[model samples]
Target: MKTALQMSLAAAASLSVFTATAAHAHVSVSGPAFAGATHEATFGVGHGCDGADTYRVKVQIPAGVTSVRPLDSTFGKAVLEKNAEGNVTAVVWTKPLADVLPADTNYYKLALRFKVPDAPFTTLYFPTTQTCRSEAGVETTVAWSDTSGEHGSHDADAGTPATSPAPSLFILPARSPGWNKYTVNQHVHDLSVFNDALIVWAGKAAYSANPATQSLITTEPDTEVLSEIHPGTEIWVKY
Candidate 1:
């Protein structure tokens, strides 16, 4: 029989997986989440709204993101909507010659390239709106604007609605030469492979002495800090 502690740990792990799956259960954006980098943001449209065929999609550009340009798609014609300041605020893609395509065949995937802001350790949410037109000339709109709380507080049990949900990306800090950020689920042996790299956990930093060892040590060489880190730990390393 499993102990009480083991049972509780297993339940928590299961909940974590469920929550992550639920968060990405809508139209999502994919790209490099590095700060101040030029990247292609691909917006994936899984299906049409309800039973109607999606004819148009509009993605709101976040304030700090600039130089927005949508890529041409064979499924639709891309249009850029600019504000009075001449900054592109939104990019809309609409099916070309709607009458030519069958109502059931109106689906699309859109992409745009832009420069991410210089903000690090921040999350960016892009709210999207999808417009669908039924065979009877009826129009339906679905908005993907739901967001987490101000400080990135996520509600695991929050039920997702029929409408789309916003897609988000986390921006990381700029790294020095040979340094990179990695998310790990378990222990990472061979810390010495990366010279002068530090392990950061919960805002605390630790270093290792014998780089060839399988574990990391605290600032004090006599004290050992960790051999295996907690799951879902994000660490910055030079390797």
Candidate 2:
């Protein structure tokens, strides 16, 4: 007889397979808040380079979400640039002089402030970009994380860019009154022959419902591909 856990695992695996095949690149929005609450949101990025690729990122926010601007970023320097709309501006990160980020450095932080107006706060969506560059300054991989973990966090695997059996997650909460902290994860993968990497295409995400733990549901996505990532590549971008 199959054990109860085994049966459950099989079901979850089947669901994951379905999601992986149908996955697409998209952004996820999560929110429902009052006018005075501070809102914190964390964006997740998965996949990084070993010594081969350097990454630069830019996050764009919707209009009028908050009057507050982004403070100094932990990952790098941020500058306010006028958006296409002309009057509105968004925060953009300035890349360092270094052509390539050191192999050991794999994470960055971007903190923003959201000051709500007298009106009620509703849903806000942030669209972002990831630029991957090679030593020759050629572009490599660019990806974004949308889904939230139970609390809204994602793990990025640097260098490899291969999908694991585990599902990745990121979170965006509704508006609140004070400043909130959003933590993001970057997974480093060594896509070099010395590091040994597997190329894979990411599929869609699928979820499993569990009654025991209302919030502790299961999710799975499929990433399958075959090709070695080019060496000396990094990502760069500005919102």
Q: What is the lDDT, from 0 to 100, of the residue 140 in candidate 2?
A: 57
List residue ranges in candidate 1 displaced over 4 A: 1-25, 97-107, 149-164, 176-236
Model 1's TM-score against the true structure: 0.63
Error of 1 at 182 (Å): 13
**Model 2 lDDT per residue over 197-236, tens place:** 0111122211123221112222221322212222232321
lDDT of 1: 0.59
Q: Determine which window of 10 residues in candidate 2 has minimal summed lDDT.
A: 191-200
Query: What's the TM-score of every candidate structure?
Result: 0.63, 0.40
Please, what is the whole-model Cα lDDT of each candidate in the order they appear?
0.59, 0.36
Best prediction by lDDT: 1
lDDT score at residue 158, model 1, on the 0-100 scale: 28
